[model samples]
Target: MAAKAHLQEQIRQLPHRPGVYKYFDDEGIIYVGKAVDLRKRVSSYFTKQDHNKKTQQLVKNIKRIEFTIVDNESDAFLLENNLIKQHQPKYNILLKDGKTYPYLCLTNERFPRLIPTRKKINDGSRYYGPYANLTAMNVVLELIRALYPLRTCTYNLTPENVAAGKFKVCLEYHLGNCKGPCEALQEEETYNQYIQQIRSILNGNLTIPKAYFRERMMAAAQEQQYELAHTLKKKLDRLDDFQAKSTVVNASLSNIDVFSIASNEKSSFINYLKVMNGSVILTQSLEVQKKLDEMDEEILPPLIMQMREEFESDSKEILTNVALPSLPLPGVTVSTPQIGDKRKLLELSIKNVLYLRKEKESMNDRSKDLNEVRIMETIKKDLRLTELPKHIECFDNSNFQGDNPVAAMVCFRNAKPSKKDYRHYHIKTVIGPNDFDSMYEVVTRRYRRLVDEGASLPQLVIVDGGKGQLSMAVKALKDLNLWGQIPVIGIAKRLEEIYVPNDPLPLYIDKKSESLRLFQRMRDEVHRFGITFHRNRRDAATLKTELTEVKGLGPATADKLLSKFKSVKKIRELSEAELVAEIGKAKARVLLSYFEQQEQAAE
Candidate 1:
């Protein structure tokens, strides 16, 4: 209590300005936060007036506060995002991602084909909008197919076919989107011109298409094809209407990104509106908690500069980059316009900002019930168990070939990892890289130790492998006289597959199923932990040759220093002065000279 009071006093002395803040739990575990006014924001949590149900809960658990003052609001915003991505605070409303939105891609081939996909491949393909609504995207696709009856088929029309005109036009040609190049009804030069026009339409150049359609309609009317002329005119009109609505937000601007930042004294939110060809294509929000003052301007300029630098260094992901202050260039009206299209875009962006703020407030209210309580309930019913699986133990084995085999067992309570209960074992029973046997040994050891201590057994055991691995697990449970007493299941490697005993092949649980994704997440985490442990073992084993039997350097510290420096050759190359620069000059000079002397003796 005295220590916490002292920490509170320290927090009160912080400046009432923009900065990042962090909260530590009673156990000294840190959760990061940001604040616009550090003094006021931090002080608010300790005051009786600020004690809401959620704030009171946070204050009760908080033991200390730490802060880093930044220059302005935007700096605080960018810093907060970076920290959130790093620490992932429990109280923060995190950005959620499951399945990626599909993109419409036109592949670059002799005969191109349009495809819908979530993944962005490196192959030469032109991708368009991350369309917010899939139904609308499909509508566009249908429209394209109806209007451009090109070869939707993947078949290549070779030189022989070009000369022979062997293939006949499909139903698509009759609809209109394509000239039957496969049937050689159109010359290559003429077909290429149509392709060029399609590209122009995609680039939002409406004039060329309007002119072409009008010309076609006029020619048909002259030839007394009244029905064709009227149909073409109707299609042309529809295209114009589609273009108008598409750019309702920013009709004049071609491509730009609009950013708006909103902040209260303690937190900030930035909304990014991605515009392409005068349309507000996508909007994303980033939230920041930091100290703010009236004098602070948005720090976007410097943050963007740093972002560009990181991008050049291949160290960061830059989704969109546009010149700040958005001015129109010589021939391009690139400036942030105050009227018409730009104003509409800005208005839409503001709406998005407000929408996210409201959504976050609602999420904060519901986050109290956001624990893996549902996970326990689902597993309990799924296994038809006597009690809820409040405590789950998952096991995984990792090895490279036959070397440095290791296994890990992770415990999850109420759907979160109990880090204190995680256990790793260097394979003792298994001599080779046999995952099944290794899993059995790992499970046996973990359970046997709990039994020896008279501790309660976990309600479930999850193996991170397929059916064969599950069989080994079942055998282990039988040996302990606990077969079927504790529910067990296996998660297969490929396609997030799952398998149970007596089941044929593997079953895929839908991504929308929270319980299933939770189980898969646990399995993946255990596998990752095991793999990490195995890598450390392998690295240690390989670096054994570089270790010094020096008096002051113990194996653990030697390993730490080696791991820190990576290789002995690099360590040897590091000058006595350089070594001092890295670890400390005192250790460097002595350590380097010692190594040099040893090397001379060995020679």
Candidate 2:
């Protein structure tokens, strides 16, 4: 109670200005927050009753508070983001498990060297990307190497060393893959021109280099230099192909940065698109783990600033799906468009973020499926089967007092139900409610057709009965010469005991084991399927019997009525005039009178 009073007093003393605040526990800083008005925001934490679970926990853990006043909300926002990144406070959404991405660095030297590095140095060098991934970075490196014969050796290509002829041409020079700049065989001006063109290509601005190549190709063709013209044409075609693969949005919507966010309960996915001259020069999606219940406005601005700084975007206008608070950064306008080409661009950004979310979900689903496959493999090994039971079929019989007895077979492939392969059977060759006989008839008919048509057979077959049904199914398989070819098991309903064909006693699988659970699921599914089929058949039979008892309703008339109305209740509900349109007036009158007499008897 004393601590609560002290915290409330501290909140009361807070200044009503923009600032960043820190919440600390015994260990260290646990959370960082920003607010436009420090007094109101800080007081609400201790006063509000409807806080989310995470926020409530955070409030309980906080033992002390510290704050820094800023000039405005934007300054507070920047300070808050920096502190979160540096301290990575416990109750902040973090981009976990990622190192700084790799970028193609061009060194600041008289002759620049292009190489991949993970660090961004402040020396007077240029960086093209933090590329989408390592593979993309490598591809760009290979493309640059092919386009220009640049030197790869890390030699100090000082003018003094080159003029003194201290270096010898290496194998790369002889193979015509390098211009031998270290030996002074390549002039500085010409090499710098090639470097400039490579830089433009890396930046996704291909117009200048592309036009230069096209003009050279045309000039060479006019001079009748067919080979040189063909070579230039090939290079131009490669440039065109690369541009064609890039996503291009509206041509006039140039020099803008786009960001969109999609979030679920646990994490937020943010996709960033860099547009230069209306083309998407770069795209990246990042996932951040949420530690507290933060709103989109709270999470997005910090991330947007981080991405902009990482990509070195200097666009005057930024586009997003949600409106952003005024940022402290000068000369920048952040707008959420409602119509026109900018809105379309915002829609495109949203589409990319959604795609990234789906891709991550799909990857997680595939991992789960692989785990399921492994579980199925273990079941196969434990059962000591000849082959992995990738395809399994289970059968169950259902009947009610010897009426409409039916059997159903449910198929499971890779431990999941395969509904299309499920089959239903009426007790064609069995009599009464004899489950063993029903099992035998269904098994024989199922495998007989499969054998006749040369269809694929299930690796395992299960019967939902004890030893009696198991013995009958075994006899049917033996009669069909398939007893040893396919493995079969039976499960009892009461104790969940499994019965194999040649085993004297039942095999008791552990109740909690995955294999036993799978067997139980298959048993329950087949039981449900069989019961549904049996009920449907019984209802149709009862409807037919009731229809035939009416006067002037023979077998043909009953069949016609059943086909037209689907049920006797539907026929009962139809008016006499509506029935006359289908049949004649005489029959319609008889049907109406029959229904009236039945209702009066019930009353």
Q: What is the number of backbone collisions in each predicted candidate, taken in the order shown?
A: 22, 0
lDDT of 1 by residue, 1-603 (tens): 122667767876899898988887866534565667888777766765634465566666777777889997667766776675567666553433313765677877766666777777888888765554577567666655555555776657886866776678888678766777787776777656656666665555656777888899999999999999998898788777767666445456655655555555455566665555556445456666542232113334333333222212121122222335321122323234466656666666667767777787778656745656776787776656688888998899888889888898889887788989898999898998898998888877877777789899988888998988988888887887777677788887776776776776775556667667778878878888988888877876777645655655557756767877787777778766666666676666666767878889999
TM-score of each: 0.43, 0.63
* Least well predicted 10-residue stretch by lDDT in candidate 2: 93-102
> Candidate 2 regions off by >4 Å?
1-5, 96-99, 366-603
Model 2: per-residue Cα lDDT over 460-579, one tens digit each? 999999999999999989999998888899999999999998798998777887888899999999999999999989988898888788878777878888888899889888887889
- The CA lDDT at 100 in model 2 is 73
Distance from true location, Cα of 406 in model 2, Å? 30
Per-model CA lDDT versus the true structure = 0.68, 0.86
Model 1 stretches with alpha carbons more than 4 Å out: 1-19, 24-31, 35-51, 63-76, 157-178, 183-186, 223-228, 244-603
**Best-fitting candidate, scored by lDDT:** 2
In model 2, state the lDDT of residue 249.
82
